[model samples]
Target chain A: MKAKIYIKYKEGILDPQGKTVHNALESMDIKDISCVTIGKYIEMDFDNISKESAELITEDSCKKLLANPNTESYTFEIVD
Target chain B: MKAKIYIKYKEGILDPQGKTVHNALESMDIKDISCVTIGKYIEMDFDNISKESAELITEDSCKKLLANPNTESYTFEIVD
Candidate 1:
């Protein structure tokens, strides 16, 4: 099974890196780009893992290492 | 319209951050975590852009700012 995990900063949190990028875009004249937030994407492939098992593994992975739960949230998709 | 843009390091490129995370996972004894690669996710909402125009804008954003074309590739989806 293949799984894709997306971890992102929660809304309302300040993101300095994203701010820098947003300013850079503004400087380049890209209009109306209200805001930008940078996050992480992780894709993993495993053998003999069912969709249910993948979700369990993914949840554990996110809590154990993939994200800082206090500041970030994560979602995952199990691909057949 | 809302658009979610996912930018990731191309396969075969080394990702030091991901490597560190992978090692951390290993240290924690999280088994079967073959490898990990980290990337970016950007979600934006606009008041008045058509899907076709949003795709064009997204392509331009990826090329000019959201991604480093030399090392990363990006994909986007328009969400209503």
Candidate 2:
């Protein structure tokens, strides 16, 4: 199975990298760009695990290590 | 319009961060995980631009600033 997880800072949090990206776009004459938020995309491959177990592990990873739930939100998808 | 860009290191490249995460997972007893790779997910919002223009700008951004074409590749999707 393969799993993908995306993690992003919560709204209203100050995202310095996003702000920098926005500014860079403006400098490049991309004035129509309004917002730029950067996040993490994690891809994982699993073997010898059932889909249900993969899902549980992913959820646990997100909560325990992949994201700081208080400030970051995460979503994941699993595929065979 | 909203655009999503995913940038990742090319295959065969060493991803230190990913390795660290793998080790962490192993330490936590998540041994079924075989491989892990981490990348950047960038989301941008645009106003007053046609879809074609948004696509062009996103491509340019990936080439010029968002990714190093030598070792990184990027893909994007735009939505109205």
Candidate 3:
């Protein structure tokens, strides 16, 4: 199985990195962008695990290590 | 318009961060993961630009700043 997880800061959390990129883009004349945000993308391949097991592992990983629940949220999808 | 961009390291490049996470997960007993990779996800909202313009800007940004073309590749989708 394969899983992809996206972890992003929750709404209202200040994202300094994202802000820096936004400014950089504007200075580069890539105009018309109203907003820009950045996050983490993780991909994992599992060794012949069932879909349920993959889901459990993915969720647990997100909660335990991949995401900071108080400041960030994560969503993941599993595929065989 | 809104755009979502994913930037990932090219094949054969070493991903130390991913490796560290893999080890951590193993120590935490979240076994059976064969591989783990990490990347960047960027979200941008545009101010009523045409799709073609959005595409051009996105590609330019990826080449200029958002991605290190020597080691990373990027893909993006734009929607209204």
Give the candidate number with the greatest TM-score. 3
lDDT of 2: 0.90
DockQ for candidate 2, C-alpha atoms: 0.80
Residue A59 lDDT in candidate 2: 93
Candidate 3 structure quality by residue, lDDT tens digits, A1-80: 89989888899999999999999999988889888899998999999879999999999999999999999988888977
Poorest 10 consecutive residues by lDDT, candidate 2 chain B: B57-66
Candidate 2 lDDT over residue span B1-80, tens digit each:
99888888999999999999999998988778999999998998888899998998888888888889889888999988
> DockQ scores for all the models shown?
0.62, 0.80, 0.86
Error of 1 at A21 (Å): 1.8
**TM-score of candidate 1 against the unseen true structure:** 0.90
Q: Model 3 chain B, poorest ten-residue lDDT window?
A: B40-49
User: Residue-wise lDDT of candidate 3 within B1-80, one digit each (tens)?
Assistant: 88889888999999999999999999999999999999998988888889999998888888999999899988899978
User: Can you give the lDDT of residue A13 in candidate 2?
Assistant: 89
Residue A58 C-alpha lDDT in model 1: 77
The best-first sequence of candidates by lDDT reads 3, 2, 1
lDDT of 2 at A21: 83
Which residue pairs clash in candidate 2? none
TM-score-wise, the better of 2 and 3 is: 3
